[model samples]
Target: MAIIECSKMDKAINSLLSRQNYLVTQANDLARSFGNLTAFEHKVLDYCFSFVKAEDTSKQIYVVQMLDIIRHLGLNKSGKNYQRVAEAFQALNTKTALYLRTYKNGKNGIIMTSLFDYIEIIEDGKIEFQFSQKVAPYVFELKQNFYSFKLSELSNVRSKYALTLLKLWNANSMGKLNKATIKGTLEEWESWFLGSDNEGKPKRWSAGRFKQRVLSVSIDELGKLYPKNLFELTVEKSGRKVVGYRLDIIQPKLHCQIRHT
Candidate 1:
């Protein structure tokens, strides 16, 4: 059995190696047929075109060397006959011409555009590029539609948590307890018990205080109000007697309600 498994593994390895070699051979054949070109050919062509009309002696020599190599490999013949090579050269020429024209119009504009693409600002304010004018309307429509659906989904989700919170709040309510009622309701409860100055907003609830409040509420009340399987309770700060209860165990959702006094 071990020998059979080993042989099977070897066969799989050989199959993969054969496929890879076949792909490499096909790629080389394709390259040779297309003006005897490789990926670097396009890059070299770009560099040559940058000085297509230059009087600079060194640039002239570089362009001459590139053209000579193309002629030596009969690439001109391939480019003339092959559709792919013709199309590639056409694209290269178009882009090179546009780049030269743009550069001539304003070298500073090219430099600024390149800098804008590379640098990101993150202080004080936010700025971003406008979408292409042609696509802007459609892009905004799609974005608005997505956000509308997302907000609806979020509202539906929040309603579930809201209902659970309301039930928990009502379950064990005492007329006027000085402590927090529901763990999440600490700020509201504090304001009701203490005063407006004490409980400002939900953001005031620290993680430790939030955890303590959630645990203070009975597990039975939590289970009755919210899905029982969605929560778990465990002792935190083991040396201390305090136990922490987590709502939405798999993906806990704790919503705090704050009321201003």
Candidate 2:
């Protein structure tokens, strides 16, 4: 692993992020969870996460004006944009589902739940919601130790693939780790990016198609985002067939600090 000092631009970004009000935090489990959200929906989800205070609980009903999300994304306030923000929340309600394995009383089972307990979009533009009880502990623990990034840093990431990659990178870095490597099988990579199908299976794509569409596009955008950093993707092969991927991100030693509010 190679270490580079933070560049001028990197320092500026860190400074700006330090002043921003929205820092999205997630436990590695939630970061690696399966979700099929659009780019705008992802932004909305992050915006909601930003409002979570250290003292907040899953049962706490948080409220935010829908326009606040639009403004935070640096979008012009328009009827169309408002509706877009509203619809994104609606999509998040169904699309951000999580299925986790659980064990209790010597029995093993699966827990199926969405990120939000419920989302109420009032006609007056106020949006109220709460995290599911099952997912609350993870969110709450993130304040102590978790991967976090500012929405300000990710506001320009237009591709869903790129956004997901950014989040995964932050998660895998484990806080101040300057160089992080993410290893996953082809199926796991697909589930992380393209998400599951109607039958609850990862969408199958030829290796060529998956690389061309998801990996290359995402890596290209991420390279632009962190020009001073290195984003390398190596394909793992079994004979002539692709089996998995190893992605390594090397950057400067600037500690990604998460502020507690």
Candidate 3:
């Protein structure tokens, strides 16, 4: 338990979050619940990451002023409409549950848990919490591949799919499948959604069903989040049958080039 002052919290906005200075989250393609976090929820989570320190394990508990957050989110600075804000944090407290991959007894396993180790609302305009200790190694000491981006870029995204794509995309914004273009059989996608959650109730989804339910809807949202062509998706087909997807991504500088061309 430690006290993070207001100065540290202000750095999320008041300081520079260059492309090099970004939030690094553990990569879990099969992540659900938290993966499905709504846009507002993702915004708040990015705000929280502004105060997290990868080097300091003792720096757990974070004090966030809701008023600053409100202004940052373009909400009325003087309004008493705390309910909306309350519900958003309540979702953070309740719905950010996830299942972390772990190994025990030389076997694969999952440890079901929530993002925050614990959360408490101190006042109508503030809240505090500790990140789970087990995730520190994955989030902070990221040595291998992990998803990351300037936290400032994610603040205005209004689509959950956009946020999910951001997580699935690499630092360069490439949509990769094991390191190259994504091309998998339509049948392979079913287990992904089914295994998305750990509740044991698997959801059956066909390629056509998934397109209508998820893919087709996510296109524009990505444009709003990325400059342009920072990420793009194309379909792969086995003759007439839709097999998988191929995502094309480019550097931030190339965004303007693609747009102009």
Candidate 4:
């Protein structure tokens, strides 16, 4: 077996992630921005994202039936399921906050906003919603650029960390690329997984705890989703201090490449 040097791997991973910035754009930003959403809320958000079209603008209102969402989750049409779906939407309306970075007038700034302008769930029938104008651009970009799977493909995913990692993978991977790598500072890794606190700050975790709770758990589930793919995690450290992480994924050539229209 060949031994790989940590410094060399870190350089290569950083280079790849850096080059991807132009292509990934707002989609990757959105992937790393939000924090408080639950697994079910993430699914509901993906379901909403599927409605975005290449030609649609931020002002477009999307109407989807609650029954369709239930069916998409592979559940029978029952009162309990309907209530659960409705509650999920309510959580989505409240929890889908986005924090984005901006540069203007030679100064750096941040944009704090919610993902949706408003959401209305009718009596077990249909839901009407609109993505916030501030976030709609990212949603549109996510659909056209980073959304690799339909809502159906994610129906069985039960972990928010796994789902978030899948979005991150799609954000970083260019179309049909055989291998993809995700590199982030340890703090970023925690933000992508645990999100932020009620104070709108990323939650803190030790490197060991983060790897065990976030990285390992996500990889285990994704392994089930893509049995043929290989995922390798490398820890970045400075002397005795942990700094960041890199996840290298080697995917089959003909893996799931479905994109939502």
User: Using TM-score as the measure, which candidate wins?
Assistant: 2
248: Cα error in model 4, Å: 1.1
Candidate 4 residue-wise lDDT, 140-175, digit = tens: 877787787767667877788888888788777853
TM-score of each: 0.17, 0.82, 0.66, 0.81
> Relative to the true structure, how large is the alpha-carbon lDDT of every model?
0.29, 0.74, 0.54, 0.75
Consecutive 10-residue window with the lowest summed lDDT within model 2: 17-26
Model 3 scores worst on lDDT over the 10 consecutive residues at 15-24
Q: Compare the candidates by lDDT and give the number of the best one.
A: 4
What overall lDDT, based on C-alpha atoms, would model 4 receive against the true structure?
Answer: 0.75
lDDT of 1 at 238: 35
- Model 3: per-residue Cα lDDT over 169-201, one tens digit each: 542233232232333445433333223334433
lDDT of 3: 0.54
Q: Is candidate 1 or candidate 4 better by lDDT?
A: 4
Q: Per TM-score, what order, best first?
A: 2, 4, 3, 1
Q: Which stretches in model 1 have alpha-carbon errors above 4 Å?
A: 1-219, 226-230, 241-261
Question: In model 4, which residue pairs have backbone atoms overlapping below 3 Å?
Answer: 35-195
lDDT of 1 by residue, 189-230 (tens): 322222222122213345366444533343334344345223
Runs with alpha carbons beyond 4 Å of true place in candidate 3: 1-33, 78-81, 141-148, 170-206, 224-230, 237-243, 252-261
The count of backbone overlaps in candidate 3 is 0
